[model samples]
Target: MGLRVSKGQSIAVRAFLSVLCLGVACFGAGCDGNDQSSEYIPENGAKIGASVADVMKDWLEDPDVPAAQRAVLERVAATGDMESLDYEQSWAQYRQCMTDLGYREIKLQKYPSGLYIEALHLAGTARQESKYEEDRAQCTAEHVEYVQAAYAMLAGNPNLYEDADEAVVDCLHRENLVAADYTASSFAEESARGEEDDYSFDIRDMKARSCLASNGHLTAFIGDDVEERLW
Candidate 1:
């Protein structure tokens, strides 16, 4: 048997159909091409979100910000939170603080190479000082001891070795084996190349000591136990 539509249900169905038809016509007219003056549709929430995203993208593209600062901002953005960049104004304040301390922009061509030049200059100065030479040699020796111990520990523990990446393991092995070889090869290389800048700690500390006090002896004794005086 076929289903039958009752008279009362048919009347209700006509009313509902009439309402739906009116709604469709209203929606179509409201969104017609004639409404070109409307910049956006209130029904679409995406326009506002997209505009905000574009503004943020533009801000991120600004090159004046330091690479470190940009890295942190990018990490925050990657977290999918927009509110984290509220601290950006605070970064401006921080930059002003750095500017007050004599920070300035340098060309990339002159940046790290300039740093190397300065380091070499300081190292040259340290080489001129006897006391700095001794202390730095001692510090280097202590560092080498640590390196040797690290390598010894790594060798005995193969499972421990597996935990670290190959580069790290290689570094440990190199540290263990390189010290003697480096010392030997350095002399030959220096002999062949002529004396080049060592840029060691002796020169660095001597320059620092000079800046602080005229009496290098007194400055060197700055950490001495004054309580040991019996006289």
Candidate 2:
């Protein structure tokens, strides 16, 4: 349950990473020569709610899951009422189920969109991590597939920023910011590695988003057309 953000109909998965990287590094005088503000955690309440609904849909239909549990999840899903939902309790049940199955070190972290489950080290045999991974894949295959497809589409398109205004790039340079040449392919690879290695923060930060916005890249990065395609 990694937290993701978006503006309007688009889930700014990459945007979330971009901003997160900035928030972590730029605030420390390491990149932007400015002190990082602890208060600047990116927020997109609308996106968070939408993302949870998306995940819940898959959870309810996950064939690998038990019917009883899915029924319980359906009730939980309805509790959102399109405004707010008890994410803590909803995720707690999942965590407890995993724990009952012998997965240790289960850590649940809150993100703007949803929760991220970190089953760091499992108990039992030497192949504990492998076993846990198998179970997780089986449980959340549909949700995982949807996310992978979205990221893959984003990664494949290299010219996503071509339409961005030149002023955006100029502003980034003027600010002395470090901007990565982001592409759909590069993002896909990075995203895959982040999951495989269990890298926290989803392999992105706030700097990227801040730099892009300062340079006027948001229009290109999060245009309505792009949102429709990604969502």
Candidate 3:
């Protein structure tokens, strides 16, 4: 699932391009090398579960909500669960949409988790980069945007800890990456100060980085070498 974060929501939804554009697996293989693209990747929990209506309120209630986003809201409303995306089906729809828009050489690979794009040389075109971006954005918005966002959030933090910051600290301590006595207060203070603040572990350490990214506290760009399938 390639979910891009929208700044409109205060939710910790990170950009999906971190996963999609770099050809990384949404969960299994981290997109540790992304452009930190404003979209693609998972979003998640804080213990306070989000209902379809709750998330929809981010855009649906707007008097000027775009027809496309409104459509996504309706689709999610029908499913009643964000994790309910039909990966194969949405990928098919998205593939055809991209092809129709002239990105015909598309190809996909299957991974243990889901389908992914092995080579979407979006850079293959000589067209203006801006134009390509516009088209790509349109296609994503219509088909995969919101569903993928919800999927990423749930996938990365399956427990859906409503307080993700606390969760990250917990994971660090659980993994023995930090002193057992480290507290959430320490985690918050440190996270607020960038990498210097340590609830017990160095945020930049490989294992620590993984814990932060996995818990939605930081972004880690993985090596481009990992295998993937795009759906």
| Candidate whose lDDT is highest | 3
lDDT of each: 0.24, 0.32, 0.47
lDDT of model number 2? 0.32
After superposition, which runs of candidate 3 have C-alpha atoms over 4 Å from their true positions? 1-53, 56-85, 107-128, 158-231
- Backbone clashes under 3 angstroms, per model: 2, 21, 35
lDDT tens readout by residue for model 2, 83-154: 223334434555565566655434532222232223222234547546765665543332332232222112
Which residue window of length 10 is worst by lDDT in model 2?
222-231
- Best TM-score goes to which candidate? 3
Ten-residue region with minimum lDDT total, candidate 3: 33-42
The list of candidate 2 runs beyond 4 A from truth reads: 1-84, 112-114, 117-126, 138-231
Task: Order the candidates by lDDT, highest first.
Answer: 3, 2, 1
**Error at 93, model 2, angstroms:** 1.3
Candidate 3, residue 81: lDDT: 47
TM-score comparison, 1 vs 2, better candidate? 2
For residue 214, give model 1's deviation from the true position in Å.
55
What would the TM-scores of all predictions be?
A: 0.18, 0.33, 0.47
